[model samples]
Target chain A: MKRLTRSAQRALDRYLHTLRTCLTGSNAIDAHEVEHDVLGHIEQELSECREPIAWARLQIVLDRLGSPLMWVPEHDLPSWKQLLLRLRIGPEDWRLAYASFALWMLAVVALLAAYEPIALGALLGSFVTARAARAFGGELDQSDRSKRWLTEPALATAALVLGGAVLLSVLPAMALVSRELVEIDTLRLQFPSVYHISQRLVAVFERPVSWGWIRSALLHGGPWLLLPLGAWWLVLGGIARWRPRWFAITFSPGRPNCAARVGRLLMIAGALVIGTGVAIGLVKTLSIAI
Target chain B: MKPRKDLRPEKWTTQLRKGVLELCVLNVIATGRLYGYEIAKRLSALSEPTVREGTVYPILSRLKQEGLLEATIEASSEGPPRKYFALTAHGRRRLRHMNAAWDLLDDNLKTLRRRTAP
Candidate 1:
């Protein structure tokens, strides 16, 4: 290519960028060849022009090039290519929005028809599409009033799926960090008060800790489960408040403050449960022999 | 900012020009190998607004992709290497068939229009 002045270069770069974008979205085969052809043609046209070609000179050549969007005739395109081209170029980048909604709808239909695998597939697709949509979407797209119908179902599903996994993970994490409190003699010799608290803790749970126990407790731990569940919520809530940004994936990016508030609520609930357990354990341990 | 596609009367003609341009490009290369710029120039001279000069590249690329055309890049004294496009054996066969079909279609259309001429 001939040397182009800054303005000429910018214009050419912008044109090529738009062409690249359209081609990428359309899934056009051998797209680089088309790009190379355009560049070669531009170089040829400017070859005769004086050195340091200006935008004024380059603009004329580009004007004759027409739009890259309509370059491939509709009939020439593969069916999928045509669909993607239409969606990508559609108004307001509605591809992500509508595609998510469509997938979610398909999932619902599949579920209705008792096709669990298909339903799960569609739900997974919806979540993926929604995540991708939100990841790429601009602030305006995020705040659009109509986005609820288009994006919320998948986003909500994603939140529920992810939030449940996080909650379930907390119990095992706590178990890993806390072995059987029955082995309190290790702390008994070092910290007398800590051993006292450990004894009270074991009395409160009335059971040993292990993977099987945790699994059973998860299903039927009853009121005893409240302490662990509260702790789980408390930790999550703290993280949500401290770094609301992290919860952006689990909730709408714009609503991190809501996550913070939810965290605060979780912390308060956690405190109440822990306080109740401590009070109950202290009473029970105090009544027993030393 | 776009070049005017066509006036109302030339709308159909502009649409027809897209398909015709493919055959025209094959015919141009059938003569001998020509670089991208020269082919665009020759086609542009024949049809200005009706057939965009810019469209020739995509048609050339499509034909090349479908094995109808092959390109070789050759260094030029002018500057950057020039991509010289030539019809392949398959391309020559496709062009022959296209030309034959066009002749048949063109003769029938001309005869029908003549019979119905107001």
Candidate 2:
């Protein structure tokens, strides 16, 4: 029932823009209902506040709604569908990313359990080599926002590789220490139950410090990787902003001559293959040695 | 207590809005579907000349979603194609029911005012 203030009208308009960005559809009816509900809630709260306090209360309400920029409209569910189409993220391709992740995890577990030192070393070498190649190659040349190293193919490969490496190294050490601890404990069973020093060492191996090393590697190497990635993003952003046509031609799906798409697939495949080879080698070594 | 100068205008506007918006919207949609801009223009012509175009869309969307009205897009010879809305059979029944209720209420209020007149 309250008449919207000029500022409230402006806020609603801004919220609508982000909702449209998140969702595209012929019917904005659902989104509009949400906006009305939000605005009405603010109005109701403002009415309850003292005259002087109303303005600040209204601002607080808006702040709680978050950056009106981030409101995803319930109606605009088509945006994800559109993006998936534009990115050529077919069901098969999406399934492949999931499958690849699962395979990498399985390989890491197998290598750690088998404990073949030489093969494990080769796996690490191959993984490092693939990552280095992808890094040195123009593959990492994507923009910072676009590439997002934490989730990107290269980083995932690096993580998988590192996880395998640590597991391979420490699992054997853990087994040896555990064996020594048990032996020591049994020998001193009759005497004052003496604790084995190797038990402490084994405890150290079991700690998640192995992944800590991986995290450290990422933190150290991230910026160097991100710099080129950021530059790539800036360049891509510039292209998208100013010359969207050119950008689309180079990057959009189904373009026969689009070097960017072909380049991306080739680079990602190369990295994954190299990473997998490294993992397999590590597993083989771990299997033979231990 | 005397009201502040600024508060008086806002209070009156809110009162006017509370009284009229649903009736205004129903009247506008009585004939046929018109996109938000047209509805705002028609509402503005009835009273305040500066009706905010932004306010109408939410009401229209709400009404459509409420199943009182159905909306669809048709090609326009003008700019972009506009979303046209029409009252459903349910909406017509509801509107007719409300209109009758309002008439009875209005009649009772008038009768009460007359009997109490000084």
Candidate 3:
């Protein structure tokens, strides 16, 4: 690149800065891509310049480029509406980010609308679009204030969904694979699948499994569920510990470094839960067997 | 200011240029793959009134996003790699339609101007 006079460089910087500022929030454009193109254009235009290109010479090029403000002429909307319009229009990733937010908002509306199917569909859509936005943004952990506001709810829900499923199902999963103790089916909920899974869990260790095993496992399994559920809490704590900013963005908002302390406490609690669960499982097995 | 309600001829002309600039860009790329600067320069020379130099970059970005145009980067000795844009098959079709429309509009405007001339 040809060296530029100090004034020329400053002029170029201001121009590019203004261009980026104008472009950054446009929904129809990727600001960075345009910035790169602008730079390339300048490089080509200045290729044959003197050893140190002067501001006057550079000004001519910038003049031809026109004022950056002209590219994004202000709209005629009312002040409040114009503010909303500003948020609505932004760089390309922001479109997906806003779409995800809109879907998330719709999911909330569906919740109030008392519609389960629609709520689930919108939640799923929000989750997908949020992930797409994150992927498109090219940052796995991007948490720009604008972007996170648009995406965090969906991402948080995703964490909750996956974490909830795994945590809830782990005990039954463990029961299937682990030794049986005092199997007594209590706390009857009318879930037919629960009944079937319960019966199968009971006889699972004895013979070819039947739904009877579920009944037996249910008796001793209630306390044991804590083990895996607690471990999941610890897993999030670990994330909070390592990437506290990401933890704050995705999970909860708190002061800096709080994730570490919070995560440590969760791990300790999880360890205690695991210990208690194992001891209870072992003691119950012995007491019931004897 | 209410832009659509504004009756300034300059403002109208600017809007008109923005609309046609896309057509002009595709036409430029239709000829051959050209780098960003080169494309902007070619269109900007249409006297910078029809197309501002900086504006071409945004248009290129949009066209590429829309899949009408695609970009390739090649190494350069002076600065960063040059981003060369070319028309996709879809772009070619769109350009052909735009060109036909422009021609029809031009002929009608000419006829109208002739009829109204004192």
Best TM-score goes to which candidate? 1
Ranking by DockQ: 3, 1, 2
What lDDT tens digits, residue by residue, belong to model 3 across residues A137-223? 433322345687788899788778865664456555655644332243442344555555455445443553468755554354544
Cα RMSD for predicted model 1: 11.6
Q: How well does model 2 score by local distance difference test?
A: 0.49
Q: Report lDDT per candidate.
A: 0.74, 0.49, 0.72
- When sorted by lDDT, best at the front, the candidate numbers are 1, 3, 2
Name the lDDT of candidate 1: 0.74
Question: Which structure among the candidates has the greatest DockQ?
Answer: 3
DockQ-based class of model 1: acceptable
- For model 2, residues A1-290, the per-residue Cα lDDT tens digits are 34444444444454545444433343544664545444544444465555444223444655544442222323444656556433532222233334334444544565778856644454444444333333322222222123232224434455555434532453354446555765664555654322433443344444565668444423332222223333444444444455545643323312223435444543454454445445544665687799
Superior candidate under TM-score, 1 versus 2: 1
After best superposition, candidate 2 residue B54: deviation in angstroms? 2.3
Evaluated on CA atoms against the true complex, candidate 2 attains a DockQ of: 0.08
DockQ of each: 0.37, 0.08, 0.40
Model 3, A161: alpha-carbon shift in Å? 66
Residue-level lDDT of model 1, residues B22-48, one tens digit each, is 899999999899998899899888888
Q: Give the TM-score of candidate 3.
A: 0.45
By DockQ, is 2 or 3 better? 3
